[model samples]
Target: MKLIVGNKNYSSWSLRAWLALSLTGTSFEEELLPLDTPEFYERIKLLSPAGRVPVLIDGDLAVWDTLAIIEYLAERFPDAGLWPADPHARAHARSICAEFHSGFPDLRGQFPMNLRREPAPHPKGATADRDTARVREIWTTCRSRAGDGGPFLFGAFSAADCFYAPVVTRFLTYCLDMSETERAYAEAVMAHPLMQAWCADAAKETAVVDADEV
Candidate 1:
């Protein structure tokens, strides 16, 4: 299996799939493309049907989209426990992952993930504020329901945690105001072994996207 992703420092979607793969302990080759570059477009055009990062190639099959990639990984490696074993927990995990994939466009656009950037206050805007509130609510609900297993949303760092890892990065980067529970969750995510590895790799990457540098 092989996973193609964008620059580690800037591609949030790519981070999701990458984290999922890592959590599964799946051995796979990685290819990183610099987003928005001519070379990147050319490479992705031939590599992925959607011309996007986080594309997974397993033998003859190619899967695009972060959620799809994660699903494929889970199905291929059932022992990974990518989703919860309990049916209800699995359903809830899928719902949250789907929500992360499709919802919160305003927060995504306004507070793009840039791991290498220093923390700063969020800019003022009703849309950003509303999105922030929604994110906080989601985090709070997930953690509250997670029981005492740990600080992860699902208590064991499943797909939902992988999906939201980048959002955690965004929150840290922009220094978004978060409740005590949200802050603890963020800290747990940042301190996860896989997350630590990802951050270390990202810190070493030299590719800089100017727009995300702020």
Candidate 2:
């Protein structure tokens, strides 16, 4: 299996699929392409239907889209327990992941993911406040309901957590004000072994995209 990703420092969707694959203990070759580069477009277009990163190529099957790649990995490695065991919890987890995939544009545009940057104050009227509030609501609800098993959103680092992991990075990058619950969840995500590994790699990367430098 091979996974094609974008710059570790800026590609949030790539991080999602990479994290999910790592958590599942899957061994796959990684192809890192610098975003917005001619090389990136040329390379990824050969593999992905949407010309996007985080495309998974297993044997002859190519899966694009972060959530779809995650689902494929989960089904391929059921022992990884990417989703919850309980039917209800699994359903709720899927719902949250879908919500994350479809919504949160406000948060995404205002606070792009940059793993090496320190948190800063939020800019006024920049969607930070509303985005932070919505994220806090989701975190509080998930932790209150399904966080008994562990520190993660669904307790055991399920696909839902993978979907939201980039949001955690964004919160830290922009220094978005978060509640106690949200803060704790962010800490847990940052401290996860796979996340730590990803951050380390991102920090070592020398290629920088000017657009994502902010």
Candidate 3:
């Protein structure tokens, strides 16, 4: 499999797809594109239907969207347990992932992910405040459901956590305040081996996305 992603310094969608694939323990080649360039458009147009990053190519098949890529990988590697084992828990995971996929515009617009940067003040007014509150609410609710299995949103790492991984970076990058539970969850995600690897790679990259820079 070959996964085409944007620079590790930015591109939240790329982070989601990359993390999901990394957790699967499957070997795949990675192609990094410097975002916001004509070359990016040319490369993505040739690789993905939507002209986006994080396109996963498995033999002759190409999956573009982050959610679609994860679903395909989950089905292909069932032993990875990309989703929860229980049907009910799996349903809950999917619901939250969908909500995250479509919603949280305020928070997203206010705080883009920049992994190597220190947090700085970027006032986003009432909308972002409310969105931040919603993020806390979601984290609290998920943490409450987390049993002794692991520190992830669900007991074990799943597609839901993969979907929200960028939000974790957003919170950290923006230095937004979160509750103790939320902080702990964020810490767990950051501490994951794959996440650490991603961060290390991000630190080594020289490419910059001006819009996402802090």
Candidate 4:
């Protein structure tokens, strides 16, 4: 299996799929394409019609979109524990992942993921403030429901964590105000071995996407 991604510091979707694939404990090749470059376009055009990063290539099949790639990985590695085992918990996880996939435009637009950027709080507009509040609510609710399962959203490091992993980085990167529970969850995500590895790579990246430097 192979996973194609974008610049680690700026590509939140790429981070999501990368984390999911890495957790499977499967040996896979990684290809990083610098975003917004002609080379990225040239190479990605040959890989997927979506012309996006985080495309998973498994033999003859290629899965585009982060959520789709995650689903593929879960099915491909059943024992990886990508989703919560309980049916109800699994559905809740999927619901939030879907919300994350389709929602949060203001927060996303205002606070693009930039791991290399120094941590500082950015002034939030009304929309962004509302979005951030929603994020905090989601995290608090998830953790409350977790009931000592573990530090992650679902008690274990599942796809829901992967979906929100980038958001965790965003919250910490912007120094957004978070409650104790939210802060704890964010810390646990940052402490994950794979997340640390990804951040180390991000710190070493020389490529700069000016648009994402918010």
Q: Per model, how many backbone clashes are there?
A: 0, 0, 0, 0
Q: Report how far off residue 192 is in candidate 1 (Å).
A: 0.6
| Clash-forming residue pairs, model 3 | none
Question: Per-prediction TM-score, please?
Answer: 0.96, 0.95, 0.96, 0.99
Q: How do these models rank on TM-score, best leading?
A: 4, 3, 1, 2
What C-alpha lDDT values do all the predictions have? 0.88, 0.86, 0.88, 0.94
Q: Compared with the true structure, what per-residue lDDT tens digits does model 2 show for residues 33-137?
A: 999889988888788779988899999999999889988998999999999998988998999888888987777776788877777865746565676787788
Residue-wise C-alpha lDDT for candidate 1, range 144-178, written one tens digit per residue:
98998878988889999998889998888898888
Candidate 4 error regions (>4 Å): none
Q: In candidate 1, which residue pairs get closer than 3 Å at backbone N, Cα or C atoms, i.e. clash?
A: none
Global CA lDDT of candidate 4, please?
0.94
**After superposition, which runs of candidate 2 have C-alpha atoms over 4 Å from their true positions?**
124-128
- What order do candidates take by lDDT, descending? 4, 1, 3, 2
| Clash count, candidate 2 | 0
lDDT, residue 32, candidate 2: 93
Q: How do the residues 28-94 of candidate 3 rate in per-residue lDDT, one tens digit apiece?
A: 9999988999989988898877998889999999998888999999999999999999898888888
Residue 127 error for model 3, in Å? 0.9
Supply the TM-score for candidate 2: 0.95
Most accurate candidate by lDDT = 4
True lDDT of residue 28, candidate 2: 86
